[model samples]
Target: MRLHLRLILTVLLAGFAALVAAGPAAAHVVPSTVLQLDVHEDDITVEMTLPTTDLVTASGIDVPVDGTVPAAAAEQLAAYVEEHFDVTIAAASDATSATGTWNVDVGDVATAEVEQWGTGAFDAVTATATLTPPAGADLRSFTLDYDAILHQVVTADVFVLLRSDSSTGEVEQTRSLGAITLDTVTGTVSPLTVDLAGGSARQGFTGMLLLGISHIAEGTDHQLFLLTLLLPAPLLAASLAGDRAGRSRHWREVAPTRRAVRRITTTTIAFTIGHSLTLALGALGLPVPQQPVEAAIAVSILIAAAHAVRPLFPGREPLIAALFGLVHGMAFSTTLSEMELSGTQLVLSLLGFNLGIELMQLVVVLLVLPPLIVLARTPAYRPLRTTAAVVTAVAAVGWLLDRVGVPTPLSTAADSLGSVSPWIAATLWIAAALVLLGTRGRRSGIRRVVSA
Candidate 1:
């Protein structure tokens, strides 16, 4: 075993040394190109970011990246990219080679500095090209035979990413399809094989659904706002809320299960309705200022946290939810609109996405609500609830500050809290179980003393 371990360690050390030695040389071999492809309703559009220095190296012509590429150089580069970049069919049924043709409309290039991978403000060219497939061709499976920079500078790496495919509910995220580069040993540029697994309309709808679920799961402000509002749900307004009195006649008492359920259901539905309208409107082309929307979302959470602590909106939690949900809806719409969907595709995606969000939202409500309600009946519940509310408020303040351009570690820590939600839920369940067990044991002991 020792001999084997030493051999393994030696191999790893040698590999590390090789990589360390090659790192500097690898950096100069070729700069990477990022290609974002969007498969629209009728055509495919590709937006490519090519390093300006690499472009000049490949074309043997000076490409300016200061502003726009110079008119003559721009034309030459466009022609070159169009001639070299193409999509080909995958071979089928014993066919030795893949053969297909596509119509390409190469657009003009613009120059800008890109900071991806710490490339450090390097000049790059951006182009939007349209590819029209043959009649009844499957756009999902094809070989993107790109040799733009690879042919000239054989070691260039091109990363092909799919930004959106409205037909399949893939949008607003950069998903790597594959990389294209020259094989060092073979001295040939290999084509990137893109197979969007199981591409269909249903797949698109499902993808949107999953995206919505993930949105709810990952969005801290949204999660915190709803949860903080629900924090005081089972308690009597007068008993816990400083100024919330006479809203319900049952003062100094926990709310009944039915009332708690009603509040949760109503508030959730109201919030959903609020965001849904905005999501639809935004997706349908309503102008939304993103910065204000983001700041407003943080503010909403802050307000909700405040309400959770005090009796700001005693019995009208649903109404408050509706008002805030509108702001959140605008935020939600930004996700859908970024996909650039139109017509039926937009409608379907919107439905699937909303449904998905609601599902996840429902899961979150159910998970936390049960323990909260159970704990509300315990003597220790009030202090615990208030502590949670205070923590949530602090996080909200951090978010508010961060959203408005103030950087703070609190915002990052608060954001990372979402990753540990399952553990939080588990802890809540364990606490609830302990509280119930202790209550039951006390009751049994009291009965025994009376009998004795």
Candidate 2:
């Protein structure tokens, strides 16, 4: 019991330590801004409204020219805008235009011409162009490039909005500034194909892999589930008696580690397969009920948590993991469904997204595995194990209830765990090391007493 308790403490400490070291890479959202796009038969129109707050945050450019600034500062700001805001239109055929690229014919665009349209607000700046297609030109397909904010502010995302109005109502389309391969020195925008139409099969597979790995890494629920499953492993070994304890020890001791790796691997793979299946099914136009799928995931987690406390089915964790994984996978498909991928681009996105997910998962697993295995061998593993397990079970139950249409503090508390992962990890490491050293000292003292 003593040894088991020590082991539990060690694993917990290690788990916590890893969580702390993960840093701010976990909570960041992808850089996305809303842009509405509209297309017409004769021409295309783009209107961009920059949010001052987001612009300031992303780039140091503080818009809405402060009247408080000196003349030099104001002049510098104007110059920056003049140099940065630009629009370029490329013709499909070189014969259509002399240079093949047409700049918005606003002659001698100057810093002084850029005016402040509103007070203390990021207002709309509109640039319009009407082009007549060549005698045998393709109007449906042409290159439209805008480097308005891309030059001075490379990191800042520019979203282009287009709206078309005819005899009927207005139709709108929006697209993010796709991969703009910029020449650092020349400040030229190189065109790269944006796979909005969803790429080939190979691409889709890669994207799915990335998406899967990412989902797991950022998934607090998944991490919590793994932690809970591992929480009682070390303690289970010390609970056995004498040689039976040792014999039970060999199996039980090895059981958690083997099972843990297996469970994680199985769950992860199953989750990938399950989600991929659903993603394909959903993406391929299968009608799936969303609410029920979500509810199913919550129920699955609750079941897994309950099973973790006391084996719902002994020696069958992997099977249970695979089953629960399927539910989790279905839940994951929700993100891909919104992407609206078609043809080759869809395939590429699926592949790229999935690859990203796998990379993150592999990193997380490698970071977490070592300390977990080390702690399982220590004496003080059991009590701590049970405590962690109990806590996990409670949280899972809360999630279950919440999923079933009841809101509670338990769910909120569980959700907030990621925020404190760093602190929790640090405390665990310190506590586990201290306990291990203390246990070693106590063992040394016991030997001296016996010899004396």
Model 1 Cα lDDT, one tens digit per residue, 1-452? 23323433344344323432332111223347998998877778998899888888887878765876678877887899998887776543114332357688888688887766554557788898988867666666667888888888875789988898888777767788888888889888877777764667688889899999989998877888888878878866674355465443322468999999899999999999999999999999999999889889888887877776666777898999999999999999988886778887888899999999899999999999998898788666655666666667777777788888997766766676565567667767777777678778999999999999
C-alpha-based local distance difference test score of model 2: 0.50
Off by over 4 Å in 2: 1-213, 232-273, 377-380, 429-432, 435-452
| Model 1 alpha-carbon miss at residue 116, Å | 5.8
Q: Which number leads on TM-score?
A: 1
Q: How far is each candidate from the true structure, as Cα RMSD in Å? A: 10.0, 13.5
TM-score of each: 0.79, 0.51
Write down the worst ten-residue block by lDDT for model 2. Answer: 106-115
295, model 2: CA deviation in Å?
1.9
Cα lDDT computed for each candidate against the true fold: 0.78, 0.50
Q: Could you tell me the TM-score of candidate 1?
A: 0.79
TM-score of 2: 0.51
